[model samples]
Target: MYKYLFLLGSSLAVAQPAMAEDGEITVTATGLAQPVEHTGQAVTVITRDEIERVQGADVTRVIQRLPGTTFTRTGPMGSLTLLGVRGAPAGQTLVLIDGVRANDPANANAEFDLSQLNTATIDSIELLRGPNSVVWGSQAMGGVMNIVTRIENGYSASVEYGGDDRVTASAAAGMTNEKLEAALSAGFVDAGGYSSAASGTEKDGYRQYNLAGRARYHVTETLSLTANARYTHGKVDLDGYPPPNYTFADADVTEKLRAWSGRVGALYDVGILKLNAGFSISDTERVGDDPSYPYSIDGRSERAELFGRVALPGQLALDFGGDYEWSRFSNAPDAGKAHNGSVHALLGYYGDRLIVTAGMRYDDHSDFGGEWTFGANGAYEIAPGWRLRAAYGEGFKAPTLYQLLSQYGNPDLLPERSKGYEVGVSHGERGDPVYLSLTAYRRDSKNLIDFFSCWSGTAPLCATRPSGFYYNVGKGRAQGIEAEVGLQWAPGLSSQFAYSYTDTENRTPGDVYRGADFARRPAHMVSASLDWESTMGLALGFDVRVVGDAFDDRANATKLDSYALGDIRASYRVNDMIELFGRVENVWDQDYAIAAGYGTQGRAAYFGVRLRK
Candidate 1:
């Protein structure tokens, strides 16, 4: 079924550009909501049109090519998507939906699984590489990924269906006439997922369903209210290992999980002062069927944040914000809770050719006490198309409920913290068709955590298991470089290529001296793509992604070699109201794992038709 779709797409000519903006600046890292070229942080932006073309199964596949990002493989959940921004631990990074924090508080690492997010609903994603805790608070140790949903001015709807039992449908409409404007969007998605574990194995297959809705209304010219809600349910069929040399497992097991989240926000602009406030809630549940693996986990999380900025007469800007968050996790015999509060402020000085930004955040957590983060950023325009930027900051991530109070968890876990710095160079004519940027960064983490003993329920040997009790390990450091080039060589031809590399290590007291390299983080990665409009109503594109080798264990005992993958897509307009398209993924049939023990899809394809009025 998937093959036929690609075939039809290949038979078609090409695609046409949609009604999308080009080169919008991002202000996620600065906390000022300004453009990237005017800020010091290293940033990468993926436009909505690009997201529509990739149509990947998950965010990992979608942004893998972005600089300093890598992916790990896990069964059913598929690629355990991990982004190594400046070589920091995946758990140290923070992900945001709109402006709301989206990292899971129930997990040991306080990391948000990109796998759970449906990219079909995303309008754009910005990757900010560097410490940004002064603005975003905890878990921004490595970087920040801000996902912005689409907003429309009028009625718009789309239904997309493809391979691996994947289907998606979405609708968005808005009214902007008269004195009021309102917009609303809803989406649904389901997938049977990719094949991994063998038959009768202890690991299970994957099945997932998701739904999301968003709405916004303008109460007045400068006042607005927005709300968003989402629900997801997924199950993993697990299989146990195959005896003796349990180097890897191929068994099938059953794991069920459900999650729901909602958020509401209000914004008011009164010339000199712009004020914004929002509240968010999330709940999660997980159930496992196997008695040896009999597990039940539940968690509830809530957060409230307020932001305000004031403009001064002399090109001086002052921004301030505060946040309070709480979470509770329960697994019957084991339970835990955490709470934290933070206040942050930024002072910015702006000039025609230079901008300086300074900010700091003070957070007090129930478990880890108080932590303070500070950052400084500055950018200067050196010439008509060149800019120089520098940034330095401190970041942190609090331990999650699972790390603090699970069956074999450690309640004494400490928050991991880091100090980071970055510098970059960018060149591009304002509103030009070509741009190039490069950045170098380094981050060091303290009080890192790791598993120590095994599950202690039965015997000592069982506790010796790899997945047994974990504890704070010590310190580590990661450093890397990122580079990108965006070009529009002709009227209808445009291309982009980005690459990243990192050096990582775990250096702490009494830790096993394995190797210099950190496990699971590839040293090199690259992504490139080209888009072109062949005719009045046809468009064509091709994309390629590559990753280097990485270890499968902390001991660095095993390694998965590097591999590259490619994909092709094309679309044609049958008429003004109808269009046809198709896509081919893994065109090279690369048989490599993002992690050990898992098989990536070789070569696959899919087709579809789109209609518009």
Candidate 2:
């Protein structure tokens, strides 16, 4: 019973902007767009075209092709999907949706749910691997994901049907002009999904819908106003232990979610000086009902942010920013409020062949007082097309409101903290005939938060509360090597491969799980893909993904077996404004599960048509 009480469940959120070219791609996650090479950071960008080239119905398909990336889903599509960079947990990897912070304020772990995110209206995804606490501040322990939505002058739509009576449809339309630009998009999904429990006999269905809008108006030559909003709603069937048997099995259970984010901002740019200011709001509501227990979460958050960049003499620049947020949440009879504010500054030198940067941050939390963070990174071009880079960052995540105000909340909990270091060398640029890079990195995290049980009699607080409360008694270390290679065969043909080797150890003293591998973190992961496009408006692609063995539980008692899966996708252009697409997933009908006791999809196929103008 105690094992079941561990922190469990997953979701994803957060975003920034990014633009890429063959070399010196721009990374906008820092609030200021900087060249990836000059920023001394390891980043991977997935464009809309790349998303279509890969087997998809979602963004996860393309996200897994990068090193130091791992994810898991409890069931089939629309399930609770979680992501991790290197060996960090889901909550440590912040996600941004169109410049808005989307992490769920009501979640016990304060993580964003990625299950509801689809690529239907997405234009690009940028993953900044490793911490850059100087800009991201809290929840930047692992990495950051920046997602940009389509907001150009155009119209696009797609519809598809697959196995198990699955149907997906999406449409987007927008306008762009000299003075003002605006766009909106919507998507829907309905599926007669299979059972979630491996031993269940009945089907568990799922239905979801989402909407997004973005607008920008040029008020002056050097000033612009921007606004964006996103909304998602979903319902899914789940399984639970029944009363009579009290065993892990199927039961009458369902979960419903309603979440949204909105932001209004202004931008000012005059070549040497740039400024960005914004105010945003995020809200989430969730309901779960089981025969045994029922629970609901209501949360809302608001934030105001401002950041600016000023160029100095001799290829030098100074960047500074600050943000304040207020969050409130309710879990039935219990309610809580939290406030946080942070300020940061950075100085950088952009020489012709060498770039260096350093920064520091100070955060004030109403619940836990204050903390400080520091970061530095540099990159040097050893040759014309090769470079050496390294980075160091310190990060901390404040306790969620739920962790401090709920029934089991602990008022004296400390913020979780981590330190990360990485260095690597690379050859060639993106799209080159041959591209290769490898990095070895390490991270140490302490004061990690976890549930402490009264039954264990570990803390004096058990004297008053009895059951359990959130506490900071966890610690660990993770180190790894990540490598990727890409090769271009013919003009329209290319292949890419990526691999990761991670070693994790739970280092909390006097704990049973100490020295054990981190739950859900595998030792190795590999991905390979091949793509071909002809001048005749035809394209074909195939990919294989492999995940090594891991443990599904902290005790490492349950072993998760290794699995490899393959997929094939093809698209044919019918005209300039229309196209036909289809894909076969889980070729060979490989039956496997990312979460123990969960059922996975068998060999399935989906066909669709796309219209664009």
Off by over 4 Å in 1: 1-27, 30-32, 76-80, 154-194, 198-206, 242-250, 407-411, 429-432, 454-470
The best candidate by lDDT is 2
- Say which candidate scores most in TM-score: 2
Estimate, for each residue in 60-171, the C-alpha lDDT of model 1 and write its tens digit.
6677757887756565443234555667767888877766666767665766766666665577788888888898887888888877765556555556566565665656
TM-score of 1: 0.88
lDDT of 2: 0.82
Error of 2 at 391 (Å): 0.3
Candidate 1 local distance difference test against the native: 0.70
lDDT of 2 at 205: 85
